[model samples]
Target: MQLGGDETRRLADFLAASGSGSVPSDTGGYIVMPTKGSPADVIRALQDLTATDRMDALAMLLREASEKPAILGDLVSRLAADERFIEKAAAAMNLAVYRQVLFRLETMIDDPTVKEGQFQALLEEQPWLFGSEYSCILDRRRWTRDEITDFVPRRTTDGRVELIEIKTPLHGKSLFNWDASHKVWAPGVELSRVVAQAENYLEKLDRNRDGILANDREDVTKMRARIIIGRDRDDDQRDALRRHNGHLHRIEIITFDGLLAIAKRVLRYFEDAPAEQCVVLGT
Candidate 1:
């Protein structure tokens, strides 16, 4: 299908998320075209498109994007996550104008792909990544409101409180080249999955705060929600966090890079913490 500007952006986003997996043959499936240019080049070309313009420019952009295979997956993912794409989708009308775009954009909204056990798996892999000194006590079987309180949260050194929830990122419906070699990752899913999981966990926490919080004045420490993605994310995720500063519930999104950073920091912090502050497995 010939994609309009918005559709083009959506396609780009999907392609970015495909991450070395195979690109789907059908439009309904995820499509990540290869790209060789710098991300800046891709975005610039996208920003300049109009309804009247032929898709020649868009095609060239995609063709060029296929070159830098290493970064293309991540670059396209970031492009799709760009706020401008969201705004454009809100303004779009024609499906041809943005059907592909709308579908990709909608993927971020209520990602149901997050399986029940996935959260628990993420937590098991990286306990300290969420700033949770205690190991996770997840009840993966149910999304019960009552289950929220059974899990214990940790307090940060800065005196903020946070509830750590780990997550896994879902890719577009297709496989990328990396999938052929078994190296799989998707940047858009990397960001959206974390953001979505954090939001869900926060809602639960807020709903059951009375059960979890001892008292209001006790200070809600950091109230954290961490997401552990299988892939890398981009600056757009950081931008999302920056825009939602005050309302962020002290939640933090951690990519593989963030994981490494935390590993180093946690070691130092643990050294200063009192022996009693150490996490006891069941607590």
Candidate 2:
């Protein structure tokens, strides 16, 4: 969701105030005081919080209000009175909606009837799957010549890149085929193909880093690859899948179920964390 000018200013102000020596008081008011650092430093710290952290803070607040009936009214009143809090709350609501959409989209990942075009589109829409620190750098308007490498998402912290490849989540056929004779589920054809493709994409990016940087201005020095395909059928398959992924060095493999697990962990962070800890305000 896009923030308007006013909303952006308010969020900045809130972040600044939070970074200032603002402490939560017993009366539920912030005790704002002088901070040691420069105003610019404080602002930078506020800006350092990733998009995921902001959304998680809001989710935490929502979960807290739900669990504690007594504090619900107080929380709502505070949110209504504080414009910054309301702005954050709105963002949190948007994230929740998006999370639900991602859940629904997972069904199509495994559906054989859904074309690759549709599956790719669905994957493009959900940037959160890459975690909170990464954002999509390529869209339809600026996709690379290579079709195997679906998109490149950059890590916000270090400008490092991840080459992502997508494949349909196949049913019955696991990521690795079960070998009853050998007592192991070996990497299946689809999994091996995608892994090789991702590795190739990584090598290509490393080789053409200068040219890519000239064109897109993204860092590809510290690069890795991710392959999204298939599903874990059962406990045995899941165990074997973990062992298989362990051997891979450059490329990490994940199933649709594994992707959802990552999302769930992120959502759970908000649900479990204390509000104060979730949104830090220096004192």
lDDT of 1: 0.45
Q: For candidate 2, lDDT tens digit of each residue in 70-152?
A: 88777767754553563456455555655675676666765778765676676577665556667445543233456446767
Model 1 ranges off by over 4 Å:
1-152, 156-160, 169-190, 211-222, 233-249, 265-283
Candidate 2: where are CA atoms >4 Å away?
1-85, 88-92, 109-112, 135-148, 206-221, 271-283
Q: For model 2, which pairs clash?
A: none
Model 2 quality (TM-score): 0.59
* lDDT measured at residue 104 in model 1 versus the true structure, 0 to 100: 34
lDDT of 1 by residue, 1-283 (tens): 7879989987687777666554555667334434446878776765655433223434444565576667657646755556343223223222232234233323432365766365554344445534445434343322324435313443434455445444444444211122335544333434555566667766765675665456444233335655444323455444444454434555655543454455446545644554323222111
Best by lDDT: 2
Top candidate on TM-score is: 2
TM-score of each predicted structure versus truth: 0.32, 0.59
